[model samples]
Target: MQYRWGSAWGGQRLLGTENIEVAIINRGRPLRSVVLEIRGRSPNGLPPVRMFQEIEELPRNREVRFELASYEMPDEIEELNLSIVSSTAVE
Candidate 1:
């Protein structure tokens, strides 16, 4: 199955800023749920924060925006994109 992510606001602001709005999409198989883990390392020597979102009953080609507890991805990270389906075991 093919999957990808999209975002509206994908960066940090001054302070007390909100994270980027992201969406997860399954291009091939019919998915039931998805757990997205958003992590980032800051240049200010800040540790990475792992955030998660649960997507339920996702149809093919449909997308869901991830709600991260922390801020958007860092600027120093080597990459920024939707994570591949790590595990998509169907029920």
Candidate 2:
């Protein structure tokens, strides 16, 4: 699985600031309630920001998209990180 920002209109923005977008792909078995941890930092050397999110359900070989907004973030992000915090597979 991988993550990246979406297009201009596809991203989520609050009051035309801080556009955020994410895509999660499931290549293994079916999963339920998948949790994700996202981290990022601005160029000004401010403390990093972390965010957590979950996907209700994800099937094998499928993908999901998410749009997020953060007022604390600037329009351009210098560094960003994404990781799968936890997930459970459905038999």
lDDT winner among the candidates? 2
Q: Which candidate has the top score in TM-score? A: 2
Question: Candidate 1 at 81: error in angstroms?
Answer: 5.5
Local distance difference test, candidate 1: 0.51
Clashing pairs in 1: 9-20
lDDT score at residue 12, model 1, on the 0-100 scale: 49
The lDDT of each candidate is 0.51, 0.71
Tens digit of per-residue lDDT, candidate 1, span 1-91: 3433223354444353444455556676766656555565555665664555577666777765555433344443323344444446465
For each candidate, what TM-score against the reference?
0.55, 0.76
